[model samples]
Target: MIMIRVILIMLFGRCLSCAICSTFHGWIKKWIQIS
Candidate 1:
């Protein structure tokens, strides 16, 4: 059970980081376009 929970947390963290990275990438692209 504990192992399952740890795996879930790791997956969640990876997904969250991916989302944040994509958002940051989009924002940078917009900023570059504006400039």
Candidate 2:
């Protein structure tokens, strides 16, 4: 049970990081377009 919880936490963290990175990339693209 503990191991499963740890795995779930890791997966969630990874997903969150990916989402943040995607958003950051999108912002950069928009900034570049504006510039």
Candidate 3:
């Protein structure tokens, strides 16, 4: 689980400046929870 988050961070780290990043992060959290 930690590794998955780490990989996601690496992939999304580049877009941290974007407003949508937070939304995408929330979605990811929800998705993880659902799974």
Could you tell me which residue pairs clash in candidate 1? none
User: Per-residue CA lDDT of candidate 3, range 1-35, in tens?
Assistant: 99978877875878875667777788889999999
* Candidate 2 structure quality by residue, lDDT tens digits, 1-35: 99967865776567756876567557768999999
lDDT of 1 by residue, 1-35 (tens): 99967865776567756876567557768999999
Against the true structure, candidate 2 has what lDDT? 0.71
Local distance difference test scores for all models: 0.71, 0.71, 0.81
TM-score of model 1 (CA atoms): 0.51
Q: What ranges in model 2 sit over 4 Å off?
A: 1-17
Q: Which residue pairs of candidate 3 clash?
A: none
lDDT of 1 at 14: 76
Q: What's the CA error at residue 20 for candidate 2, in Å?
A: 0.3
Q: State how far residue 24 of model 3 sits from its true place (Å).
A: 0.1
TM-score of each: 0.51, 0.51, 0.51
Question: How many steric overlaps does candidate 3 have?
Answer: 0
